[model samples]
Target: MSTTSVSISQKLTLSGSSSCNPRLAQAPWEFDAMPGYGPGSSEADPVPAHAPTNAEARPGQLPQLYRELPEEDLHERIRAAKEALGEDLVILGHFYQRDEIVQHADFLGDSFQLANAALTKPEARYIVFCGVHFMAETADILSSPEQSVILPNLAAGCSMADMADEDSVEAAWEEICEVYGVDPQNVTPDDDGKLPILPVTYMNSSAALKAFCGRHGGIVCTSSNAETVLEWAFERARRVLFFPDQHLGRNTAKAMGVPLEQMPMWNPRRPLGGNTAEDLQQAKVLLWHGFCSVHRRFSVAQIEKARSEHPGVKVIVHPESPMPVVDAADASGSTDAIRKFVAASSPGDVIAIGTEINMVNRLAAEYPDRTIFCLDPVICPCSTMYRIHPGYLAWVLEDLVQGRVNNQIVVPETVAAHARVALDRMLAAKPK
Candidate 1:
């Protein structure tokens, strides 16, 4: 049987040789104290170096007692807490989460899917989200006010989400509106009945960015529904300003036959987003300079290597990868699409996947009859998602059972109102 998770975890614990960072062998608490994105596909990314360490962002330490407990004991504690709380609690796990955490999840899927799951449990008082910060925030936004969303660890933040902030996006919007000679807050449609631009943010972004989209007649999009969302945007606007994920924006638009020249990259650091006014005017989609660190590690070279090693290998990748990598893959899609692809494959088919190692590994374990493996051979998971170890999940669940809500993710009411508009549009834009 293909046991990728076992190999990866063994390397992390016993050898520490499969990963780029040897520090990954230590407990998460040991590395959370450091100033970096932690060990994973983003181990070398420059963006996380300047951001606050996981320890600093967290409300308090994970506590020595929890960290010192054995892995099996921690799992038992989580199980006990769940039993004690019964229907009052629901745990949501992302596709990229570790096996230990995923096994404990009441709902296992992508960020949006998991968020939607929480809504189904209206009677549940607490939502323990075993995902990144933005995901928990999204749950808090979508669920009823009485329900609470908790992140297992405060440090589990997306590096890509950090790339685009409110200030940078707001500044770009002002400049773009000026170039079009329109008010940033109140843009009017031209004779063609299309607004000058419509803001669109990926699900990987912060709640503030999503709120910005809501206020500006924009919509939020997941990787699976991005094309449909873009089609929705184009129906109301001449151009789409997509943020917090350049690859997803560019790849989806390009698939829809938008010319490369018409999709410009917006660098917030540069003047006019480092583009000429003429270029901006001609653009169909303005992609922000942001990307998921895990997906960014995929390359055309890796695809070629997989193809060479296993003839007739079907390579599937996430759209968050670079254009060339997606182009080289046999198919590129969201996490759910990838899962469906594997499910549809023949029992003996060889599949190479380009995504977080944990997700790929889980798929491999699920379909042991097939030769399913990650395109990137390195055992790097998403650093942020990996931060949600069993220890954090156990601690959070126990705390909730004890009537304490730790690491609760609450979005401001004003922001949630606007964000809800964009999210609702996203829900409506789902292709028929």
Candidate 2:
């Protein structure tokens, strides 16, 4: 399939939730429970080994309590749960989460920052992550063995991260190795102290992929430091194979003067990624066929509309956006970076942002003096991120209050060891 076709299909899959509001999808604790029980329902159910127990709603039906509970009541319960747990619990919220959930966060930042934040609070027994599934896994990999990480909703998963599975990536690696005549078991360095190619994975990927990078002399990168990581890779390798985000790799490499002709998209299903041997040999960066659904919704037309309607409007977008959108914007960075850009602006400055709706709305509310709005006015949130509702937050925190560990995310020791190496390398890499 073409890149556009792939993006559309993934968008449909990512947004496929039973509830009209994705956030109302059944929580893991709701499943198999008695029908009359609500959010604080203590009634036990026989949880299946493979199925999620927190899921409360019947197939195609939304949870009654989550839908009916007043916002004030939810807040009160969440507060009571947190106060009961005290310092024993540390809630980390990503900027993309809804304001209701973020208001209860002990630490609010991007994924990489939150992972480091998890390490700082070693005293906390539970780390409740108000983010997607992969983020909870990263926390599990980084936190101490004694500390348990919890993702409020088990259904919360990243579409972009799911695009590049381990099997497909391994297959691609083998094909590239054959093309370059390099051995994974025993790689030989060139005269310039560089290997043939290095794998660089974005932090948005799975922990297994991070381990893959660690084993292959590769490193992990976040949007804020992608350029630095790529520079580090190029110094030690002839070319780089970046996974789980084609736009980021392409935009970052292009900014460093790497031409588009030298960056080939790798569709794992296609033979040799649909490239000739000569093309593969000449490539500077092999980009995996993946993209962020939320970021992909942004368009150059939105930028134009913002400019036309609001004169002197400053447009800022996430680097995960398409190249055209990023190029059109005045600035592009991570979610935190976009927040910083808006924060630094003068009062009365109109700013248009291209990112998740929850964050944009929160920023607009935070900086009332400045006119802030999302470029896509249709309210498109990261479907996975939105799965984390305040109701789920209350449920998990209350579980801790009851001296039970519910929905704890634990990365296997063997996988965690390798994943940590790549994460450490990312933390050590200095910005260019």
Candidate 3:
């Protein structure tokens, strides 16, 4: 895809001068200069060195000037930039993002929906994704070549996605091939002409892994359609390797009547993935040891508390939550599913949601008559999702107005071609 510069008749002036925000002048995560503190560093605290120190930092921090600017001024600048750019720009926001950023989004939905939204906007030259890193990468893989996908903050990365890197997964695949006595080069299909094993990656994974799936005849799946994708895999493969989130894989497979004994966890750190040849042979689904930090926080205790405090409360959670938490909740679904659940509820209905704090708060405000609150009283937002501050949004948009593309996410041509096959298969899989 060719990258085109946006031209504006009038240069939009930001609320604060460039001097006021020194960090904004340069990318925060310049890991090349800091040898020991780049992304995926083996430090005790896995956060990148350039991650924001706090929501409010001293004058030198990247967002300090943004924090200092009046909310009205920031809003005004964002409006002006959007108006000046017109249809060439499209802003996509996730439900979990903070109100400050979500309010400025032209389209709001979950990651999969947002990726599809990017495809629909063929006229949009730039897709400013107000979500995490992987979501932008997905948009880049699916959108037209002429369209450029921009991520506001480089630090906005998914911890779950980081857990299952391409190197680790590739290594695991080789070990599995040996354990199953299957040749990676020449795989003999079953009597039914199905492959012995298939790799099914969650939509939250990297583009490289999606390409890996495409090359191996596997497909991608979102939380909303995981079961459907799994069924599709099972029909053509004897066993499946599901990755990035063990909770989702286990829960979905269990519901489909797969026994726990048949599902084994693959620990990348251990030899043979911490499983014996016998264990591998009996496995129906090999799950990766990865989970979402936010969803992992939910517990059955929280569900009980909601039930005790408000009798007849409806408990709905994301499928990423642990099996027990999902089982205890009244229902579990994707972010869009949670929204629809609340919208379908009657007035005065007491609903306790198990998701990010920002989304629950927004729902409460949108439906004032209904009593909607987060299950966990303590504040816990997706730290990665929170990285897309309004300041970053303004910075990227303003850069576009000046005929520049900042933090653009582009997948390699071969990778995009392969990844698109899996994504297209996902789009075709009908939900049964």
Best by TM-score: 1
> What number of clashing residue pairs does each candidate have, in the order they appear?
0, 10, 0
What residue runs in model 2 are displaced by over 4 Å at the alpha carbon?
A: 1-68, 430-432
Better of 1 and 3 by TM-score: 1
TM-score of 3: 0.86
Worst 10 residues of 3 by lDDT: 1-10
Pairs that collide in candidate 3 are: none
Which lDDT tens digits does candidate 3 get at residues 277-371? 89899999999988876688788999999999999999999989999999999999889899999999999999999987778888998999999
Off by over 4 Å in 1: 1-6, 9-19, 48-50
How many collisions between residues are there in candidate 2?
A: 10
The lDDT of each candidate is 0.86, 0.79, 0.79
RMSD of each: 2.4, 8.1, 9.0
**Candidate 1 on 122-141: residue-level lDDT in tens?**
99999999999888888999
TM-score of each: 0.95, 0.86, 0.86
Which segments of candidate 3 are over 4 A away from where they belong?
A: 1-67, 185-188, 430-432
Query: Candidate 1, which ten residues in sequence have the lowest lDDT sum?
Result: 1-10
